[model samples]
Target: MKRGDIIELIEDTTFYKKGKKAYFIGRSNFNPNKIEIVWVGEEQAYKDGDIDEFPARLFKQVEHGDR
Candidate 1:
C-alpha cells in the first residue's frame, strides 16, 4: 500500500520473521515491486535511519488500532 501504512509480516521470509510489524516507508527505488519498511522493536539496534526492503507479497497492511 501507500507510504506511512503499518504492515505486518504474514509469512516467514528471508528479511523478516512472521508477525513482525513495520512501518511502510515506500517502494524500493531499484524495484517498484519491492517495499521499504522500518521495523518496530524495543531495542535501539535498529537505528532511526534503518530501513529494509522486502517483497510486497509477503506483507499485509495493518489497520489503525490493530493489535
Candidate 2:
C-alpha cells in the first residue's frame, strides 16, 4: 500500500485484532513485505522505523467514503 492510505486489519493476527483502522505509512525499510502502519486512534502521522509493522497480506486497503 501507498503512504497515507487507510488500511484495515482483515484477518486475526497475534498482534492486532480484526477491524482496526490504521494509516498506511509504507513498507518497512528492512523488509518490503512488512507494511508499516500506525493505529488511527493513536496518531495520523508517523515516521518509519518508529512504529510496529505487519505483513501486507494481513491487511487490505480501506476505501475512503461515507461511513
Candidate 3:
C-alpha cells in the first residue's frame, strides 16, 4: 500500500509500537514494488513470520489525492 493508507496490524496482537494500538496510519512504503507499509512507529516485529496476514476485508483503501 502507498502513503496515507490506513492499515491495521492484524497479527502480533500483543505487539505495539509508538504507543499505538490496533490501527496504524500508513506514512510511507519501504518498497513500493513489494507493497510494504511503513508507519510512523518503528518496526516492532523482529521476524517477517511474526507478522500475521491481514484478511482482504480488513484492508481498506484510502484516498490519497497527491504525493
What does the lDDT read for residue 18 in candidate 2?
Answer: 97
**Deviation (Å) of 38 in candidate 2:** 0.5
Structure candidate 1, residue pairs in collision: none
Q: Is candidate 1 or candidate 3 better by lDDT?
A: 1
Q: What's the true lDDT of residue 33 in model 1?
A: 91
For residues 32-65, write the lDDT of model 2, one tens digit per residue: 8898788787663454335778888888888552
Score each candidate by Cα lDDT: 0.78, 0.77, 0.38
Question: lDDT by residue for model 3 over 1-67, one digit each (tens)?
Answer: 4544455543443444332222223332443223334333434652332333333333445444245
lDDT per residue as tens, model 1, 13-58: 7656899998787899999899988787622534646678898998
Error of 3 at 49 (Å): 4.7
Q: Supply every candidate's count of residue pairs whose N, Cα or C atoms clash at under 3 angstroms.
A: 0, 0, 0
Off by over 4 Å in 1: 42-47, 64-67
Misplaced by over 4 Å in model 3 are 2-5, 8-42, 46-49, 63-67
Q: Which consecutive 10 residues in model 3 have the weakest lDDT in total?
A: 19-28
